[model samples]
Target: MSDTPELPWPVPDERFRHWAGQFADMHHLVRDLVIPLGLPQAAESVLTTARELIRMSYFRYEFMMIGAGTSIIAIEAALADRYGKGNLAGYLKKAHADGHLTKEQYDLLDSFGRPIRNKYAHGDLTHVALTPPLAIGMLRTAITLLAELHATPSPGPSAGGN
Candidate 1:
């Protein structure tokens, strides 16, 4: 048995696109809806947008890691690196904390959002396949997570400031 977790889904361009779009929609929601409502100052509005973009990009990293982790597992039954398939959540959490990912990365991941992409790519689901509900849930989670990331102020000039 491969030590790595089988991909929850596949890595096809379509599936990738589906995953990506879902997250993209989340960013779009933040930009079109959240920003307008938040009414953030111009200076901060851009940062807010950047924050959302970072969150969105992390999704792509997660998707890629899913593929990379699986591929790593394929190479060896056991994960040679501790940062293997099981550690994706941590990776995302850390990236969110560090603010390393760029808008481009998030855009790339959002591109992977497609229906049944994971099912066919990873061969995880049997007959069920990646359903609309599940994809929506994933998208929701992405949005929630991204929002959470932006909710807190970064440890910078304004972090816990007057």
Candidate 2:
């Protein structure tokens, strides 16, 4: 038997699977749509566009991570009002401190996700070698973290009217 521990929440495999199919379908649809517009007549242009689309789709995990991080920062900023304008690391730290993320989740983002994202964003391609499994794991973690943070109840006014 395997010794892996059971996960506390469901991993988002179905959504990712569906998204993968949709991404591929999008390429096909784009190709079909452009055929009537005389794009396919320029074989080089069609191939280039298709290849670029596939390459972009392959990095969907990175895009999702960046998007999720941005969303977390936005939510935190909205809650903290004037105090939210800062770097992603600072925002993530604040989220952890505010009980939005657990210690493990925070560490995962701090250690792996954030660094990879930074490297990718800064055009440090040599350091951004992401495998399929790693990308999937990171995507799952990001989704889980975002979902948990969004589900948490916001603090409200005190009952004593202070």
Candidate 3:
């Protein structure tokens, strides 16, 4: 007998199970059909990685947007005393220019992250494709931005007692 312990079968909902079965069947059929195409192993590996990166990019974009939105809300709340009527991008730029974000961090977000996120949000996926490195960089910048926004001190009365 095998040394590995038997795991209990997961009981999924009927609809989910049905869909999963269909997906698996289709995947196997596609694989079988494509095997005869004689694609190089390296090319297949790259294709697989590209597919995963595309899926991961979409996931990261959604969370990055959420994180950025939450960070904006925090910044707005903290600076409510001095808040002005403006767009989110304006506030973000003001925050960066005012020394809230490091120069490198701001540059990364402004130059790459924001435009990609906007494209995805506006359903313009055809115009922008995200690579794994780019997605990772954007996520890192977003995390840093959120942390900085969260750690910011709330605005208060002038120090000179104005």
Candidate 4:
């Protein structure tokens, strides 16, 4: 007999299969998504790690919050990679001002994205809540934004000679 112990809670095969389906759906989402290779390695690692947490969250609800928190951190890391040494709003403002992001993109990020990320980053854990859909949405948004950030060419040295 296998030495493994059963979980205290019931984990029926059917339920496990169902969770597998959810995991597959999440895997497929990330599989089809691609981020630029030019991005800082840390940003890519963070995104991947966040996705793994999201996958695990399907197995356990607690992981969902951790995954959600990591998702926003991944976004922040991507922003830091692109903009460097600044807060979310400042980085986004620079992105918009430089025409790297469209007005709508900026507005979308500024509206809910900033607040959600801040809620986690600033440690508002008691009030923070997350569902799989919302966590997946956050992951998707982070990847999309990271791609956009990397795809945009950084401004070169100023035209005028030093």
In order, the Cα lDDT scores of the candidates are 0.36, 0.47, 0.44, 0.65
Backbone Cα, N, C clashes tallied per candidate: 23, 0, 0, 0
Please provide, for model 2 over 50-133, each residue's C-alpha lDDT reduced to its tens digit, 9 standing for 90 to 100.
Answer: 334333443353444443333333333333532334676776787789776678767766776677656656766344544433
Least accurate 10 contiguous residues by lDDT in model 3:
28-37
Considering summed lDDT, which 10 consecutive residues are worst modelled in model 4? 10-19
TM-score of each model, in listed order:
0.25, 0.42, 0.44, 0.64
What are the candidates' C-alpha RMSDs? 16.1, 17.7, 16.5, 4.9
What TM-score does candidate 3 get on C-alpha atoms?
Answer: 0.44
| Highest lDDT scorer | 4
- Model 1 C-alpha lDDT per residue in residues 42-133, reported as the tens digit of each score: 42343344344334433443333333222222212111121244443344334434553344433322333321234435764333333333
Better candidate number, 2 or 4, judged by lDDT:
4
Model number with the top TM-score: 4
What is the lDDT, from 0 to 100, of the residue 50 in candidate 3?
A: 31
In candidate 2, which residue pairs get closer than 3 Å at backbone N, Cα or C atoms, i.e. clash? none
Write candidate 4's Cα lDDT for 45-107 as tens digits: 877777787666556655655665676677666667666688988977887897655776667
TM-score of 1: 0.25
Model 2 off-target regions past 4 Å?
A: 1-83, 153-162
